[model samples]
Target chain A: MDYFFFIDLIQSTVDGLLFGTTYALIGIGFTLIFGVMRKLNLAYGAAALAGTYIGLVVFLMFDAHPALVFLASALGSGLIGLVVYLCCFRFTPSNYPMASLLASVGMLLFIDEVVIHASHGLPYPYPSVFRDAIIELGDVWVRGDLLFVFFMCVVAMAALFWLLYRTPLGLATRAVSQQPRAAQLCGIDVTRVNMMTFGIAGVLGGIAGAMTAAAVGVLSPVIAMGLTVKGLIVVVIGGLGSIPGAIIGGLLVGAAENIFLLLRGVTERDIYVMLLLFIFLTLRPGGLFGSAQTRD
Target chain B: MLEIADIKTSYGKIAALKGVSLDIHDGGLTCLLGPNGAGKTTLIWTIAGILKAQAGSMKIDSEEILGLKPHQIVSKGIVTVPENRLVFPDMSVRDNLIAGAFSRRKEKGGIEGDLEDVLTRFPRLRERSEQMAGTLSGGEQQMLAVGRALMARPKILLMDEPSTGLAPIIVEEIFEIIGGLRDEGRTIFLVEQNAHMALKYADRFYLLEQGRVTFSGEPGAVDHDEVIQRAYLGARKAS
Candidate 1:
């Protein structure tokens, strides 16, 4: 390849890596919930979109600081997560995974429609925490917002790891994820652990939403469908319950889709990513790091 | 001490335990012997708080615990090593043992010490502490299950069929362990299909038939051969 083309490819790779960080955050959220409850929250993407709207509302109402806007949006999404748990998951039969899956899908549409009704199907300006400045790294230029998102993603994952491994609550959550009955016998309060997991996952999704909106500088109901698809793909490719798997899978998918766009075009990007997911499922159903114990 | 009075539990419409009552004194190995489908496991489940009793009362040291959740019963120092050696298959042996002490929050240092003590008692667990509980052999898994229960530092340990699917030597080893536990003045309530083992290890035994206690007494008072014949082969004859 020509030197100029080689440099462009390297820059594209950098771009993919930057965008992949957000995908990794979303995948972590999905995997965290699925690992414990063994159920998919189809509304996860919509929950993120709803969080963006919450950020917009905060910005418009109080002209709040960017940090406050992010915090308010995250809290709003966490509340929505609790509602989803109480309305969809709490009463559903424990053994019926499909029932919960369907309920989550219903929730996804409900939230999406509500957003559409409120915003009138128009894309609203989402206040950017990071101004759209370009950072020069040698020959390549990187967006400041994308770099900020990458930093936030790292912070979120670190916090999550600390919550999961360093604290008593994390120990109880892991116990419940591995063996709910045994956890209960140990007096871990399984339901509370589950609800907390949901809330935390929702907060992660909310952060992803805020980051995405900040990166693009706009929010729309249309983002829900695409984000939902991307999140699901990332979770499956990462393995359902493996935290590290989600991060690795997210980066792989992000880079792969970008490479596909570079080689072919935007139209075939998702098809190649979906095909990669199919291949992973066929060869190693456990994702990269998921153990056989996750099978049921 | 434990008292189970007139407990009735059902699955849908079919009753598993029907007005079953029994009293176990403190500091003895009491075995419950019955045939398959004789509601022995049902009684164990109810007492462990896995299944709610429709009508009954269960007391641990005179505290009523019939309607409490499983963890609550565990907090009250009544723990069960459930049938099939349900030792949290995915977790490591050490993790499983640590989970046994989950109900107790105080005495972190003491709990760690107790874990060490259990490892010494069941050396096999010490050798395979990092191994997943599911990968251990049947006999080893049984040892881990018992060791996990012991880690709870429970006042009363309820074991259901710990000897099932083990070899003859392993069964004898398990009985020896139970014997040692009794010698230490720990209370154990065992449910077993092996009449011979029950007679050998249990201080008092209850013969259950279809959810009701048909016989209860010291091992020496009952005819050992007759109980075995009836328990294993359903041989009911005139007195």
Candidate 2:
């Protein structure tokens, strides 16, 4: 094999790994809420897309710094999450799981349409936080934007793990996740824990949205369907409620898709990814780290 | 001490407790004896704040406690070991015990000490501390539930049918533990269908029939044979 070909392979691997970080961030958002409430916010991807729109609007109108734009966008998405919780989840009868899921699906379409109407079907230019070019390694190069997004994702994951395993709030959240009735009996405010969990997930998703926009340098309504499908695939692949599983699953899906694209082209890439998902669902429904039994 | 007065609770239109009243003094075990569907669990739920009383009041140490959330009631130091021992099945036995003390904001060291004490009291729990609670046997789960409640350091522990579904030997062992808890000066409000064990361990007992308290007195005052017959057959022998 040519030395340059080997370098290209290493570069693509790094690129896949870097892109996988964003997927992991999105997966964590899904897993966080699912872990505690056992409810999937199907609109999660839409929420992130909505956040990107917010950042774009702020950057255009106020000429805000990238950091402020990201914060503003996250706040907007967080509010959307709160609304989703109230409208879609809060009042739905607890026993009606199907109804809740349908409501979330409805929410996804509703938000997507709103974004499309607002943006008038045009792809909006998104502001980048970093101005550096790709760093070269032999024949391989890593984009600065992708590297930053990867670092952000790692930091966010670390923070989430700390919040979940190290703090008192995390303990309370875990208690409610395990046994809502018992948690209530122990005087833990179950509703508050649920709200906070959703909020944190929304914030992470918002950051993910901004970082994704920065990575790609553009935002469009078209990305909603693809991102939503990808996020769902990640959630299923990672197991419904396992954090570590989400991270691993996201990376696996990212790298596997890249390798498939290299070997079989884009048309067959999703086919292989979907096949991987189907295989996991049939053989190891719990994902890699998920417990054998499904939790309610 | 706890006082429940004229509490009325219902499932839709059907009333479970209709203006029922009871009192439990401090530092003694009081058993509520009733047949199936006699509103025993309903009353327990109401007192524990899981079910709201439609009419009437509940007071703990003279503080009005009706309508408080279950956790709020727990913060006031009243904890219930619910029927069926609804332990967190997927969680470890240790996690279940930790969950019992969730209402407290105290020293970790002290909580650990209390955990150790509970483990010592229920050696079976110690043996299975790392095991998932769902894997424990019925008898061991009962012990785990009671042990979990004890970790709360509750001022009043409401236990519902702690001996239900246990073997006779396990039942005796559980009653012995209950007797020990009573001796340790914990205020216990027990709901039991097991008249023999209730009479053996409770300082006072209440008999609820058709959602009304038909009998309340010291165990010795109630004729053992009559109470047993009433509990099982819902009738008294014609003299």
Candidate 3:
């Protein structure tokens, strides 16, 4: 590659990695709900953005700082996630996985429409928390916002790990994920576990949505459909119920999309990513890090 | 003390427990013996609150528990070590033990003491505390299941088919544990297909057949009943 091309490649790769942190957050939300309920929240991305929007309203309403905005958005999204669980999952017959899946898809459209109507379908600039805090390391330049997002993602994952591996609630969640009926026998309130898992996932989604909007510098309903699809792709690639699988899958997607943008232009970048998703589906459906399915 | 009176449990249209009633005296090792499909498991599940009784009453010392959720029953000091030792397969044995005390998580000090007690009771479990439960041997898994239930600090421990798939030697070891628990004053409701072994440990024995209590009396009565002899103990061939 030429000198400028090499520079472009490096820059794109770094940018992709930074943005991948957001994808990791969204993927975590998707995987968490899947792990506990064995059901996908197709509206997860939309829920995240919905949280961001509500947080925006609160931010503008109270003249809040970016941190407050992010927190408000996250908390709001958590509620949205709970609502989604009640509507799309709680009452639906569980024997048919497709029923819940379809319900979530419908939820995606419903929430998107609600946001569009509420916002009057106009694009709004999300508050930038660290956009001006750029870092320079010789020839490599890093955006401060991206670095902040990256830090947040790492911290969130660590907290999640501690909650799952070191606490009673975590134990209950894992037991429910592994065997709902057996967990019930252990005196675990399976419904409570499931509900809490959804709430947790919603918080993750909320963070992801806020960070994503900050990165793009704009928020609109148009992003929801694409995000939901991308989130699904990341979950499938990361192994549907695996936590670390989500992180790895998200980074892989971010890196690949950036490399493709340089090689095949913006129009063709998505096509190649779609191809990568298909390859994983056909060959390694268990995902990059999923444990082998076992029978007892 | 536990009371089951005129409890009817149905599986869709067919009734599995037809107004069957029984009482388990406190601090006794009471055993339920019957052939397959005779609702032995059904009655245990009903008392455990796994299945909602269609009609009738169940109480633990005047606190009605009939139709209560399973977790509620557990919180009320009734824990069921379900059939086949359904230990959390992928979790470590230590984690499984921790999960058993899930309802008592707030009682950290009590949980720690109960866990220590359980581990002491099963030395084999202590040796393999870090191992995944799925990797444990069948007898160990059964031990883990029982140990897990004990972590609940249950006043009433409900065990279903403890000796179903175990070897003869292992069965005796399980009975010894049952005897130990009774000695400790833990109320036990045991469901067993091993009529011969059950007879030896039972303080009060009930013989159920075709969804009703055919015989509710001493082990001596079960030994004399030709139906119980031929059906459960295989003591005599059906003539």
DockQ of each: 0.52, 0.56, 0.68
Superior by TM-score: candidate 1 or candidate 3: 3
Candidate 2, B1-239: lDDT as tens digits: 79989999999899999888899899999999878888999998888888888999988889999999888888888988888787788778988888788777565567888899999998889999999998999999999889888888899999999888889999999899988999999899999999877888889988898788888889888788778667655655467
How many Å off is the CA of A60 in candidate 1? 2.3
Please give the ranking of all candidate structures by TM-score, highest first, separated by commas: 3, 1, 2
Give me candidate 2's TM-score against the actual structure.
Answer: 0.89
Off by over 4 Å in 2: A1-10, A129-140, A290-296, B89-95, B106-141, B165-167, B233-239
Candidate with best TM-score: 3
Per-residue accuracy of model 3 over A1-296 as CA lDDT, tens digit each? 68887877888899889888788878888888988887888988998889889888977789888889889888999999999999999989887999999999899989999999998999887787678888886666888888887787788788889999988889999998887766877889888898999898888888888888878777777878767878888888998888888999999898899999999999999999999999999999889998545533
User: What lDDT does model 3 reach?
Assistant: 0.86
Root-mean-square deviation of every model: 2.4, 3.1, 2.3
In model 1, which regions exceed 4 Å deviation? Answer: A130-137, A281-286, A290-296, B106-109, B235-239
A94-128 per-residue lDDT for model 2 (tens digits): 77788888999999999999999999999888887
Candidate 1's displacement at residue B33, Å, is: 1.2
**True lDDT of residue A221, candidate 2:** 81
Supply fnat for every model shown: 0.53, 0.64, 0.73
Q: Model 2: which residue pairs collide? A: A187-B71
Fraction of native contacts, model 2: 0.64
